[model samples]
Each structure stands twice: as structure tokens, then as C-alpha cells.
Target: MRLADLTTIGVGGEPELIVDAYTREQLVSALNDAWDGDWFVLGGGSNLLASDEPFAGTVIRILTSGFARIDGAPEGFQRVSIEAGQNWDEFVAWTVAQGLQGVEAMSGIPGTAGAAPIQNVGAYGQEIVQTLVSVDLIDEGSSEIVTVPASELGLGPRTSELKRHYGEEPARVAVIAGITLDLRVVGTDPAPVADERIRAALSLASDDAVTLAQIRERVLAIRASKGMVLDPTDADTRSAGSFFNNPIIAEADARLLPESCPRWPVEEVAETVQVFDLATWDGQVPRVEAPASRVKVSAAWLIENSGLPKGFSLPGSRAALSTKHTLAITNRGGASSDEIAELARYVRMRVSGEYGITLNPEPVFVGVEL
Candidate 1:
């Protein structure tokens, strides 16, 4: 089967074979067999960029679907377990209809819920790490199914132990069978919203009280504006959402960036707030990763400032930057995988040459290099 028909970017070459697994047992068997042979597992195909050359192996498509609200999880929270192949936006829409609150800010994200924790998917100040209680995964080595707590996943801004970045193997080689989220239960009423990032994203007043549905709409609108939301007719949406990750660099290197560039500290103020009683507190300071504190610079800002503006592309190439967001490298109708890679390489070269900092891509690459 051609990956061009399977991936969102619509640029890849064919695979040796395509197998769709619609049940848990079928999925497990497929993974086990793939481990013994050359194979690749594909999910929603939203976060991948493959080569125009053939994949040279079997491709297993995850098509399983199921979701349930499990009993005895926690108080004031709804614990729901979702199969790996369940459509992400569909699940978010369902949660909004049910009056759930935690994932409302992540409303229009593409891909499946199972792919969420792999990259610690987040938007408007909300992330999967906040509510992800556990995940049922299949270990590639043992071929055994087990439940792993969210804490052990080591989820950060856009990383986890299980996400395989370019030139870097994931800390763990396992496939998630199901994801369990413990969402805040708002029932059916407006809740006071206080997350600054979310408020900024939605352009809400600090004191605004909003319902889960309202948050979802605002988030979806924001994503659509940036072409982050999927639309078959929109050429800007024909790409892996963000071509590059926001570069997380040392504070010293960040100071070299232009003052107008947007940046965030790894150890954010929200996480370091003091809530303990001062009168009863001891004098000892808690140990922390001093070097863990970093500065995340905006990749989009660098791209534009480095002379690659929105919709920019090499002459005669069909790959272009998203008109709405510089972060996305889009297929301007019939763009080849090589064309996409060329654009990516050009962007990286320009940005690095101008700023001396390398920007890493966010998508998983298969049979392609930049």
C-alpha cells in the first residue's frame, strides 16, 4: 500500500504490505510478528513524514476502537480508558459533551489519544501529563501487555521516554494498547479558569468563568487559524502539524536571541510556586536539577527572522511553509517527500546559520533524512 494515501502529508512511497488490526488480540499479534521481521506500525498517520522511496517492510495500521469510564479511579475526576486507535478529536469532542474539563484546551489536535503521551501533547497550557493516570502498553522485547503509571513516562514539554526523535532512539520501545486519563469532573457547569497560557490562547479575561464546551470551541478556532486543525481542502493543513519543535536551549544561548522572540523557561513559575506554610517550614532547600532549567525559544520566530517567511518555498518546489504558521512545512498540492525534506533542510540551515542554534523537527521520519 502507498503511504501517500495513508499519511496526512500524502507524500510517501509504498510499503511491502498493509495490515489493519481492528481488535486487541489482532493488534498484539501484529506487533509481535513485526518485532521478528522488518515492520512499521502506523496510527493516525498525522505525525509522520516518510520518504518517497518504498518503506521496505510490512506496515501495520492500528484501527482498533473502544473507550470506557472505569470505576474506582479517583474522587472528583472521571477515569476513562481509551483504545490506542480511537480518533483523538472524536474523543475530545465526547469529553466536552460529557462536561469533562482537563483536555478541553487540547480540543483540535490531530492524531489518536494513544499518541498523546508519546510526545506529551499539549496546547494552551494543558498537557496529557496532567491527567494521564496510566497506559496499557505492549513491551516490544517481551511481547507482554502491562499497565504503566504516567509518572514513569517522564513526560516534558514535547518529549517522553517513548518518543523517537530523529537520530535518537526512544528510551523504551513499546506500543501503547490503551490510555487512561483522569479528567476533572465539571459535570455540566461553568468552571473558573485560571491557567494563564489558556487564558492567553483564548483571549479571556482573568476572571472569566467558562464551560468545557466553550473552551473547546475557542481552542478549535485557534488551531484552525494556524492550520493546526485538519481540513482536507486546506493545503496548509496537508503536513505533519509542526515541522520543528521549539528549541530548548541553555539560558545563555537564549540571551543571544533577539529580545522580540518569545521564550519560556523549562522550570516555569507555575510549577515553582510556594504553597507551604512558612511558619512551619524548615530551613533546608530541596534538591533540584539546576541544569534542567532551560529556555525554549520559538522556532517560528527564528524561521521568519532568518528570512524564511510564511508560505516560503524554494523555486519550482511544491513544499511550502504554512501560510498561517511558520512552524509547519506544508505540501502545496502534489509535493513530493523529497520536496518536503528539502524545505525542512533549507529552513534548518537558514535558522541555524542566522542564530547558531539548531532547530529539531517534531515528526517521526521513515526512510527520509534532513
Candidate 2:
């Protein structure tokens, strides 16, 4: 299968083989087969950035399906289990309809449930780590199916044990099968007067019974405006969500920015703000990497100020920035991966020349390095 067909970016070359597994048993069998022959686990294909060259290895596309309630109070709280292949936004919508509050802000995120905990996916001031209870994984070395708690998963800032290669080689392949989340159920009535303030703080209004569905709708609306939702007709949604994780920097370093820069404390010693640099990768690539020492700046802001306005492009070029958002590089149609890369590089260079900061890409590149 062509990587362009599988990825949201609509770029990349073809793969050696593409196997879609739609059942749990089939998924497990496929993973075992990949382990025997060596293959990569491909989930929703949202966070990946593959190369333009044809991939030589097998691509095991996870398609398993199922969702169930495993535990928690039937009246006030519940633990829900979901298969890896279910669309993430759909799952969030379903949970919201049931009155779950834990994942309300994560609505409209592309990809599958299994991929969520992989990076502890977060948005709008919330992260999967906050509510993820456990994950069922296939340990490649032992060939055992293990259920690991969230803590054991080693989740942090778009990384996990599965990503860090803690106990195995860097390319060690493991297939995530499912996950469990602990969700709270808000009752119809407001809490007693003594606890009213606390309930309000949590967004549980005194007269309004906020169900999960309402929360999901609101979250989806917010994501849509930001071009985070999936919409094939909108080129703005043609790439991964945010291209960079906001950088966390020391409080002293953050003070160097203009007073208009937003500041928030991530830890006692660290404060973060989003800054953008267009001169990243030394002008060879338009990329953004979040350094641990400086507050993460907005790539969009850097691009606009660097003279690359939204929809900026070379004359007669097919690739351009999304008109709705400056952070995305869109395919005006038939745009190659290299073309997209070039535009990204241009943006990065311009931003750097203007702001002395570099922008980094958030997508995972394969077959080609930028």
C-alpha cells in the first residue's frame, strides 16, 4: 500500500506489504507473525511521517474492534475498556454520551484508542495519562500479553516506555491491544451546599446536568476551529495535530521573552511559553524541536512574523501553508513529500531569520530524514 493512502499528510511512498487485522485474535496472530518475520505496528497513521521511498518491511495495520466496561460503580463511576483499533474521537464521543468527564477535552483527536496511551495523548489542558488506568500489551521478548499500569508505561510528554526502548532495542516492536480508563459519573443533582464550591470548580454546575455527550460536542467544536479535527475537504486538517510539543523552560529563561508571552509553571523550577524559530535545521529543513530549557513558543506566530503568512508559497507551487492555520503544511494537490519538506524548510528558515528561534516538526519521519 502507498504510504500516501494511509497517512493524513497524503505524502510518502509505498510499503512492501500491508496487512489489516480486524479482530483481536487476528491482531494477536498478525503481531506474532510480525515478530517471527519482523514488522512494524501501524495504528491510525496520524503521528507518523514516513519516507518517500518504498518501505521494505511488512506494515501490520491494526483493525481490531471492541469496547466494554470492566469495572467501577455502575451508578457514579466506571472503568471502560476499548480495543486498539477503534477511532479515538468516536470512543471519546461514546464515553461522553455516557456522562464520562475524564476525556472531554480530548475529543476530535485523530488515530485510534491504542495509540492514545502510546504518547499519553493530550489537548486543551488534559492528557490521557490523567485518566488512563492500564494497557494490554504484547511483550515482544517474552511473547506474553501483559497488562501494565499507566505508571509502569512511563508516559511523559508524547513519550512512553514503548517509545523509549527501556528494556529492549530502539526498534523493538510491540503491539498494543487495548486500554482501560477510569471515568467518573456525575449524578443529576448538585452536591450538598457544603460541597457546592468544589463541585463547581470541577465544572459540575448546580442546576445543569452535564453529560459526556455535551462535553464531547463542545470539545469537538474547539478542536475544529483549531484545524485539529479530521476533514478531508479541508487541507488544514491534512497533517498531524500540533507540529511541536510546547517546550518547558526554566523560569529565568522564560522571563527573557516579551511580557505578552504567556507563562505557566510546569514545575517549581520550570515555566513554559511557546516560541517559534524559522531557521531550524540550519535552513535545510523546516522543523521545530522543543528544547527542555526554553518555554515552547508558537510555530505559527514565528511563521507569520517571519514573512511566511498563512497560505504562503513559492510561485506555481502545489504545497502551501493552510489558510486556516499557520502550523500546517498542506498539499494543494499532488504535492510530493519533498515539496512539503521544502515548504516546511522555507518557513523554518524565515522564522529563524526573524526570531532567532527554530521550529521543529512533530511528525515521525521514516525512509527519509529532514
Which stretch of 10 consecutive residues in model 2 shows the poorest summed lDDT? 189-198
Model 1 TM-score is: 0.93
| Segments of candidate 1 deviating more than 4 angstroms | 268-292
What lDDT tens digits, residue by residue, belong to model 1 across residues 1-370?
Answer: 6898888898899997788999879988888777877777789999999988887787989898878898756788888999999998899999999987789888888888789999999988999999999988888856678999999998998999999989899999888889999987887687778788888878888889888899998888889999988899999999999989999888888887789999988775335544667898797667654444588889999999999889999999999999998999999999999999999999999998999989899999998899
Residue 298 lDDT in candidate 1: 92
lDDT of 2 at 153: 79
Q: Which candidate is the best by TM-score?
A: 1
Give candidate 1's whole-model lDDT: 0.89
Best by lDDT: 1
Off by over 4 Å in 2: 36-38, 72-76, 164-173, 187-211, 269-296, 352-356
Model 2 per-residue lDDT tens digits across residues 1-370: 6988898878878887778989877777777666656367777788776767888877889888678887663456788999999998888777767766677668888999998887778865678997888898887744567788888877876668776321233333467889988887753332232234324434555555544555556667766876778888888888756654444456666676666655555533334454557655344543555444435455676676667777787777788887777777777787787777777678767866875666666666665445
Q: How accurate locally, in lDDT, is each candidate? A: 0.89, 0.71
TM-score of each: 0.93, 0.80
